[model samples]
Target: MVTGLKPEKMAYYKQLHAHAWPGVLKKIKECNIRNYSIYIQKIEGKYFLFSYFEYVGSDFKGDMAKMAADTTTRRWWKETDPTQIPLPEAAAHKQQWQIMDEVFHTE
Candidate 1:
């Protein structure tokens, strides 16, 4: 699941993420993240993203650490991070974005 982001910054965010940088994509794959897509709702200017992947690799933490340590990933984040509002658990700071409780789910 993704988090809510402001509408005004939507286009810039979308454009950047539309074609994720090669390095960034490589880093994500290394981290076991795949089949990711983000969606925007105009009525309330909210953002949503969905990702699915197989966690076959054992070192989840190590993979994440490696991804975070990448210079290219850092640079990509610099551009798109501002446009995102991560949930509480994922937020860099408390005020950045509030985590929403899931009320429903269907498979």
Candidate 2:
């Protein structure tokens, strides 16, 4: 998924992720998401965030619901959401992160 970062808040965002709360990390794992990673890049003076993770569960919606219901995750989002600028696509879809199509991948 992809989203934009508020330039002024980039440092704080990085700091938060650098020492993510243990409960938040535990909740993510409990949701069956693995190999999660986030990358940032600056393009045309805009900072964009890209996140990738492997979902190894059969019930995607259920896992997501579980994650969302976690208090720690909600708290985490509260802190990070303000630091993001959702792209048009995401806004249109009422989502913070816009899903992207995989053009190429190799194992």
Q: lDDT per prediction?
A: 0.69, 0.96
Q: Pairs clashing in candidate 1?
A: none
lDDT of 1 by residue, 8-107 (tens): 7887877887778999988888788766555665444456543334455679889868987999999997887687667667676643334345696676
- In model 2, which range of ten residues has the least summed lDDT? 89-98
Candidate 2 Cα deviation (angstroms), residue 23: 0.4
RMSD of each: 3.7, 0.7
Task: Supply the global lDDT for candidate 1.
Answer: 0.69
TM-score of each: 0.69, 0.97
